[model samples]
Target: MTVPMERHIARTRIRDSRLGQHNVRVNPGEYFVTGDSSVMIITVLGSCIAACIRNPLNGFGGMNHFMLPQSDEGEWNGVSSHMRYGNHAMENLINEVMKSGCRRSEMEIKLFGGANMYVGTSEIGAKNARFVTDYLREEGLKAIASDLGGHHGRRIHYWPATGKVKRLLLTGGEDSRVATAETTYRSRLAAAPVEGDIELFG
Candidate 1:
């Protein structure tokens, strides 16, 4: 019952950094990809999963934020959105870059977020970490960097063409916003279209 990624990634461009360059902001359950160097794709997360991937040769790169690791869990509003799932998020991002003149072997990957924001056995963060790790291994890919598993949130900045990422840990003033986001996502999960049997890690 998580919100669709497409809902958060609005087309309206906004300036997110001091460099004065145009950037796109992605909220929970959303993803963004681009080959444009000027557009810096950014997002904030707490216990959410986001994969930053790029192909240097083709200057194509992008990032995605997913709440669930798998897509076969259940449906939301009678629809199963693969984009909101980690597996599909990775698939979508990788395929787009590959189509832009990159290969799987040349792809550089970086992972972020997946923090234990709340106390629970769901361990969504850990599951997300495991999911990403397993997926990479299955694809025969290696990670250039990863900042995962902790009690804090993170703000990630990624450069697709260069495959460079800047991860800033979030604290203090960020608690409220992160809490709000978590609440929103959880509320959606509570409103599951399947009524039961669906598991959400957020």
Candidate 2:
């Protein structure tokens, strides 16, 4: 499932004047990992998920933006399967962080994204939220915090080195943009059609 790093890694890195740090935007089907204290990883989500994991002791962490819970196929619309699926996204981020001398036992995890953009349609956001929580539990890991399952999108700013995340709910036209982005991306994937009423149990 390992594709070229260029395919999943965010290519654009800019210096944030306000934060005075280098920031990279992780688009859907992308993940970024860095140990630099001056680096920040950011992503926008709508019916998707991003797992921000870091080891406070060593100041090493990363973030992943996944579109779906899982995909058995090898690729989807030219997107790497590993980058688009939660299972592979989590595994890749963890492995990359671990490679930076961070231990799984010492990892500090925070979850974000998973917004239900379409009210009457599939509850893909809820499914993503449930998938990540369950995934962590099965791995014997726990998320320190999470923001999921709402009727809006989110813009996340994460400092992987420090494990500090700032979330901004998409509003106005921005919110519509996020939803449209997800819809466009989702339409490209060969997933099962939404049928019946999908609900998330608290």
Candidate 3:
């Protein structure tokens, strides 16, 4: 039997007040924006990348979780064209922060994820880490710090208002949950490459 969408979502949330009562959890292929100093933004990642960005002066910030870099030739089949790609994701997050009364020059950027979890295939995680690093340099933006390219996953907690981050690298059993989420995400991309609207939870 399938569960109701609302119930499923409620059960999926972290439920820890440590992130604050108004915190938002960003899932793969989606982003969340806010200017509220009291709220937090969080996500878990494996191979995928989540960029935590904020404008210090205005206290506007957001986080985006993207699975891959853009293809130079063509668009992705079913995924939201811009949201799931690194370049577009980065641009969108910045745009959202700016729209909330922040400027690009005052932004504090920190990136997480891109672990080399796959044993045999190409190190997509490494590629992803390298891609973001290069992209920022090319755009003349400096990332304050990054936790990228390792054999482990990450649980990221970002306080947008203060531009503070608590990046916890996962090990042992923590790997199972992140691995499952990433596997399901890739399977969705493979099974149905079509455009659809994504609802924002925050």
User: Best lDDT goes to which candidate?
Assistant: 2
Give the per-residue lDDT of model 2 (tens digit) for 93-126.
8877666656778789999888887867668888
Q: What's the TM-score of each model vs. the native?
A: 0.78, 0.81, 0.78
Candidate 3 stretches with Cα past 4 Å from truth are: 1-20, 69-84, 190-202
Candidate 1 lDDT by residue in tens digits, 1-202:
2211222243546875789666787777667777676767778888787888877776677888866533355555554442235656677677766666667888788899778777778777777777788778977888888888897889987777577778898897795588578767866754543222323121
How does each model score on lDDT?
Answer: 0.70, 0.76, 0.71
How much does each candidate deviate from the true structure in C-alpha RMSD?
A: 7.6, 8.3, 7.7
| Candidate 1 regions with alpha-carbon error over 4 angstroms | 1-12, 16-18, 69-84, 189-202
Superposition TM-score, candidate 2 onto the true structure: 0.81
Which residue ranges in model 2 land beyond 4 Å of their true spot?
A: 1-8, 69-84, 191-202
lDDT for each residue of candidate 3 in 1-202, tens digit (9 for 90 to 100) = 2211111021123445774546578888778776666667788899998888876776677788877633333455553343236666677676666655555666789999999887777787887788788778976788889889889999998877788899898998888788777877866754543344333212
Is candidate 1 or 2 superior in TM-score? Answer: 2
